[model samples]
Target: MLIGHAIFSYFPIIKGWELLVAQFNRIDPEFFWMLAAGFLAQLVDGALGMGYGVISTTILLSTGLNPAAISGSIHTAEMFSSGASGFSHYRFGNVNKKLFRTLLIPGVIGAITGAALLFYLGEKNAGWVRPALSVYTMLLGIRILVNAFRKKTASRKVKNAGWLAGAGGFLDSFGGGGWGPLVTSTLISKGRTPRFVIGTVSLTEFFVTLGSALTFFILLGVSHIETIAGLIIGGVIAAPLAARMAGKLKTRSMMIGVGALVIISSLRALVKFAASFF
Candidate 1:
């Protein structure tokens, strides 16, 4: 009772609490939906090293927001979520320093370039770009699934890994998300170790997302604060757990999960693109 009186003496604590509750009550129901989306997306992304942006973007599109606004909000939230995921992966000993170094600069540059193009062009080019990227990613997913069933072969070096990272970063920023499906799938198909590839890619994603988010903030001025906040909170909460799962899953199981997620996301994108025609 004395503690409560002391707290009350210091401020209008009850009034402030009431106001906060009122603010929360007034928040759009979409915030709660986005919160759930963020948790699921980050869980998949952390474990498989992809899908957060794709999942979040798909949900946002249903809200009738334009491509630029969706991308802006997703990337802005990704800055925090990916940072947390990267640290969590690092803690789990999943990050490959060499691969991370290879992907970092090129990924950042490509992300900035893509974000700039998306800002300048808006959604005018999304029709063709989305379909093309979706088809390509779907093919990659199929390849990954097939590889999961094949006999183990000698791992081959990924030629022009920098170029692949650049392409991934570009598409992820431009199309809302494809980095994991493109870079991770390509690397795994090349016979790279799944654990290291996923971890390194997850680490690199933070920088790529940082570049894209900054670009969006500059061009778009950070609209959708509540949506971004919801995603960040949910993703952050799930990051450590997802990273632990990444470390524990078998290589084949991880590959299968990654392949399925990529295929599903790509198919969804294609369907949405097709629907736009009507």
Candidate 2:
């Protein structure tokens, strides 16, 4: 009798649940596509420590959304995904505390500055920035690939890591994604362990992305709630798997994968930018 009474007492809550289901049903089919993109992007990012934002932004751009909306939505969704990825990496002992600490504040500051600039200045100058960054990342990718064929050596302490993180954060916020390729590639190229570099960078990304997302929210407000929700769900689901892959993969294999992904993504960006002129 008590159990029956408890169930009946929650009838209003059940009615609210039904309402929520109705709202979900009304969402556009695009949510499913975003979910797939988020899953694939997060999987790659978790394993190799880059590509989430780039992949998500590229797909979003194809839908013809404005840059502000794309950036805002991607950053918002990234907060959730990065949080999950960071936690998973920590659990796997992949994070480097010193690197995370060094990268945190500077990255946040740069991200905020970048978001503000993008809002005020728009993407008028993106043409120059995009190709330049693409070329830089492509070169970094080549360097990493070359390193993979060389004998292993002791990891070196990265020089000017703070400046690197700051620049990475700025580009990530302004261009809608570059943090992973810029930060992760540079660190790995400097002889840091690929796993730790990926892990620390992924963890730092949560805070950096949070700064950008908050700034975007203040300036643009949240427009694509369904897309964000889909990405969050997909990314969260893939986080653990990706983290495990990063931890278990061989150093050489991981470096090769990271190098290839960075090169391909950069080349794609360069090609896309060039095609715009014709």
Candidate 3:
């Protein structure tokens, strides 16, 4: 995580890596703006070991991309980002194939269904998600605080791993959030240590997201070719450094930071929802 943060902190000052200044010329004339979002997201993930997409997607959607499009596109972009991270963790033997396998079926199924639902949120009574998000945020904050104080443990019981992973993948695909920490937390609660859980969660998310991301392209025909390419390059170049840093990271400290962001994001989303009632 130290290296990851260094890479992140350096991106702004580096030249010849002008992803920061690039913008979508048409509707998003500032492509670099989105990359900046990606940069921050990755930094948070590096430092906190979670929440890259939640941060980036929220920022991206603020630019007016359809929420479904943001969900699909970010997942698509992060595929490469995730792919590498997953590979590294897999190499470390953190992944549980038997557990991850069960998730494949329901994950794909639920993702497709979720994406379909997201496509129409603008047309439906979307007002509901706000309060829901607020509640989710409030709860996430509480969860973090409690967990921070409690005796920490992760589950080693692979028995329910499949069900949990699939469910996490499904919810993450649909909401475009929660997959990483969700899986990590559940596995940890069951018996896995934070180290193995992080590795497993990061690694497995690659395949789960990759499959669903492809489906998004097939179904929605959306593309962010250049942006996705940029993220891949940036993410790849930074991985080795991130891997080394993550090893030295203090887990409890990292979770508290991320938990704070999640609560803030959730509250912001919910507050927007509440304001709309007026």
TM-score (C-alpha, index-matched) for candidate 1: 0.91
The number of residue pairs in model 2 that clash at the backbone is 0
Residue 160 of model 1, lDDT score: 98
Tens digits of per-residue lDDT, candidate 2, 58-85, equal 8888888887777788899999999999
Tens digits of per-residue lDDT for model 1, 162-185: 999999999888766768888988
Each candidate: RMSD: 2.4, 3.0, 8.6
Top-lDDT candidate index: 2
Question: Candidate 2: where is the Cα deviation over 4 Å?
Answer: 1-27
In candidate 2 the C-alpha lDDT for residue 25 amounts to 93
Candidate 2, residue 149: how far the Cα is off, in Å: 1.8
Q: After superposition, how far is residue 121 of candidate 1 from its true place, in Å?
A: 2.4
Candidate 2 backbone collisions, by pair: none
- The candidate with the higher TM-score, 1 or 3, is 1
Model 1 misplaced stretches (Cα beyond 4 Å): 1-23
- What are the per-residue Cα lDDT tens digits for candidate 3 across 152-269? 6443455665566666665666566656655555454444445555665666667777777876787677666656655556565554445455555666664555467666766776
